[model samples]
Target chain A: MNIHAIKAIYRFEMARTGRTLFQSIVSPVISTSLYFVVFGAAIGSRIAEVDGVSYGAFIVPGLIMLSLLTQSVSNASFGIYFPRFTGTIYEVLSAPVSYLEIVIAYVGAAATKAIIVGLIILATAALFVPLEIQHPGWMLLFLLLTAVTFSLLGFIIGIWADNFEKLQFVPMLIITPLAFLGGSFYSISMLPPFWQKVTLFNPVVYLISGFRWSFYGQADVGVGVSLAMTLLFLGLCLAVIWWIFRTGYRLKS
Target chain B: MAPILSISDLSKTYDTGFQALKTVSLEIEKGEIFALLGPNGAGKTTLISIVCGIVNASSGTVTVDGNDIVRDYRAARSLIGLVPQELTTDAFESVWATVSFSRGLFGKPKAPEIVEKVLRDLSLWDKKDSKLVTLSGGMKRRVLIAKALAHEPRVLFLDEPTAGVDVELRRDMWRVIRELRDTGVTIILTTHYIEEAEEMADRVGVINKGEIVLVEEKAELMRKLGRKQLALHLAVPLAAVPDGLSAHNLELSDDGEELIYTYDTTGERTGITTLLQDLNATGIRFRDLQTRQSSLEEIFVNLVRTPS
Candidate 1:
């Protein structure tokens, strides 16, 4: 709660990101541009529009969500893992900082990076896809909410992870692929009816659809339902994070 | 004055079924240097961890200045600081930033002057701007100490503060520790080096096998447990111990070059005079004789070797 503690946490975490700042910010923008070049030019030229929005524009929200989710998770996970790896966690844990203060600081710093990367990807997509914002405020809302939600989830992952390998295992093998298959590049409607229903089971579909709803004012799922799913995921991630901090799971024992 | 930290019937058992601490009770008085001595895996770190609220105890309680460590952790933790055995600091951060940030963890208002003084005390002020990874191993240790002292806690625990430092840094660290003690801070240090505790501790506690074997004043523990060895260099090497000199516990060197007699110093008679008379009666003459008293290291080994 104290500014000094928050600043210290932010500074320490931001210092970690600062090491790869150029990568965190630039890589997403570049990747997004590449996607626009390949997917927008190659795929959009053949397919006019998926849901009354141009194919290039339709994929924008999902791409931004992909970048935001992965970057947020990676940033927060590494932010916390490095301390344990370098053995600096002992100093932090032994200090007078409470569990809540530590969690908020690291998660908040990670959310900051994820938000920046999301914005940059958005801007890059604008250059190629004629991106328009049906509801700019809602777009920001989903962006901030998803960033914070994933950041908290990443915090828990970092604590549970024992080493570097484990840190990447969950995000890379599980979360990223799930997000990609959950309709980041294509609309779930393009799939067969069976696959379309199956896509509904992928939690990431709700995040992307919710974000897309804010952008093009059209979604495979209801916007309110998408928002509900994001809030649900946020609550679930927060609960897990709170439990880790309270139990002193990997951080203490 | 009252003790700043009180641990009563504290115990910890890890999930691996290792009982690190058992029914350990001790009081660390304010403004005193208390040393915890033990062999590897004797739970010195566990005890410190429990007091600092880093590791929880399975049972019992630790109170720092009347605040229970678990129930009132915020207050208890705020009053104490711990320097871990590992020299773990933010490698990419400057020494000043790391130390100042540690101060902030306790929600302390910014006091750059206090931070500078602490760094200066630990000889880390010059390297304040240097990144931690750029410093040598000894400098990293000093930064850890500086961070621990940044908040100016009433109690400080150094868990093997000088495990692998060079001689110069070790001495300098002790000097700084002594200075901190002089300033009325309670310091509890755990070290593998017995000489550190021997030289600096006012009271020493020996822990072994999850139990506190003994806790006594340094001088008192030495007086009660220390022994002396009278090593006699014979003019002629003896082939075997004579029957007449067999009454005393005398050990002949493997090469038959010397005879050694171990005696308890606390006893009324050391039996030196009688042993010399017996040696002479047995027609044994020693060209030289020397006596050496047991050091804290020997006493510590003996103390832990005994059943707790």
Candidate 2:
């Protein structure tokens, strides 16, 4: 838990996240521009505004969160998975550095990359479509909290995965589709009441809702509910990662 | 002085129900090159792995410099560095960075000069900037050694350190090992190469089928357990051996050109002269004679061939 150890581990891990910087900086910018073209100009003409703001402006926060979640998970998973693949986990397990130091270092680096990507998407969204933040401070807080929560979730995925395919399988197939269905591109209120209730069960809805609330002063869910859900998710992820480290799961064996 | 490492009745049963180690016990002095010899399925690597704390012991205890390995893991691990059988290193990392990072992993403050010296000692300074994937197999092996030595461990374990390398690299590795030993480091090596143990070890322990069959001083072990062979060049090619020469217990070469006699050197009386005279009385004569000693490999084979 010493700062020196954390610095070394963190430095090494961040240096290894090549795809994070590439995907984080490029994916969001590209995806946000495309979303502006397809959903803003093409689709916006067909549908009316949802919450007093333009439809293009409505999807900005959700698009940013999309990139944030995927980049966060991919960065953290690859960071831990490479060591296991290369047999360097033996070196880590045998080292004097504690498990908490390792968790903090990796999760922190992933969060840093995720946050940077989030900011870039937010800035890029302005170039294509005009966007404004109603609660700037809460927006920053929500962005940071979501990044940390997803980064920790990625750490758990990294530890549990044995192969490269398995690493991508969960994030790409499960998490992304769930987030998309949770109303990243459209509002869930447009669906039947049964589906609306079901959307509430999706953890990503709270993250997207919280991020959307940051901009335009409008939110589908209560601001308190979204913040509380994010904090709860972050706590759950930290608990899982801590338990894995404590039991030395997949690490010692 | 107390022994540097002690293990009491250590055993390990893997999850698959394969017993890798069976109630093994030994004490290694602080500055000796102890070689553990065994065939492919033996418990040599298992024992070393347990001591290095990579694998847990099913039962029994291990202590390094008076610290229990399980109870004082960090202290004990910091005292030992293991060069694994596999040639694993950071494929993209420069040799200098890899070795220095290994030192940092042990919680040691950065010491670039010492790291440089260790690299230079291993003849890797020239390749310090080269990526590990660019290095040859032998060079990669040396990198593994440099990384293990970066922390300056008190006890170093080389587990089959030279498995597939060529003769030149193997010799160079031995040279470095000797230099390390001279500096008062305890070395415990596991190898299937009997010649390696014969050339370098101060003492040898043979493990077979999850058991330590024998442990003894190299010279004394050879002297006490080894057999000598006497071969006689025949004066004339014999169609068959005479019945009277049977008491000498001689074996005829397949070509019928030589007679082979085997005896124990440790015996007070070899009876070679008596056998020669008896052969002469039986109308046999030899143009020349030769004697040979059994090698460590032969003795190793004999030891493993014995029943439990």
**DockQ score of candidate 2?**
0.44
Worst 10 residues of 1 chain B by lDDT: B86-95
A47-155 per-residue lDDT for model 1 (tens digits):
8778788888888898899998998898888888888888778766766667778878999999999998888888777788787888989899999999999999888
| Residue-level lDDT tens digits of model 1 in B89-142 | 766788888888899887788899999999888888788899888999899888
True contacts reproduced, candidate 2: 0.33
Interface RMSD of 2: 2.2
- On residues B109-208, what C-alpha lDDT tens digit does candidate 2 reach at each position? 7888989988988899999999999999999999999988988899999999998889988998999999999999999999989999999999999999
lDDT of 2 by residue, A68-151 (tens): 889889888888888888887666665556677878888898889888888888887888788889899999999889888888
Q: Which model scores highest in TM-score?
A: 1
Interface DockQ of each model: 0.59, 0.44
Give lDDT: candidate 2, residue B268: 88
**What's model 1's lDDT at B155?**
92
Fraction of true A-B contacts recovered by candidate 1: 0.75
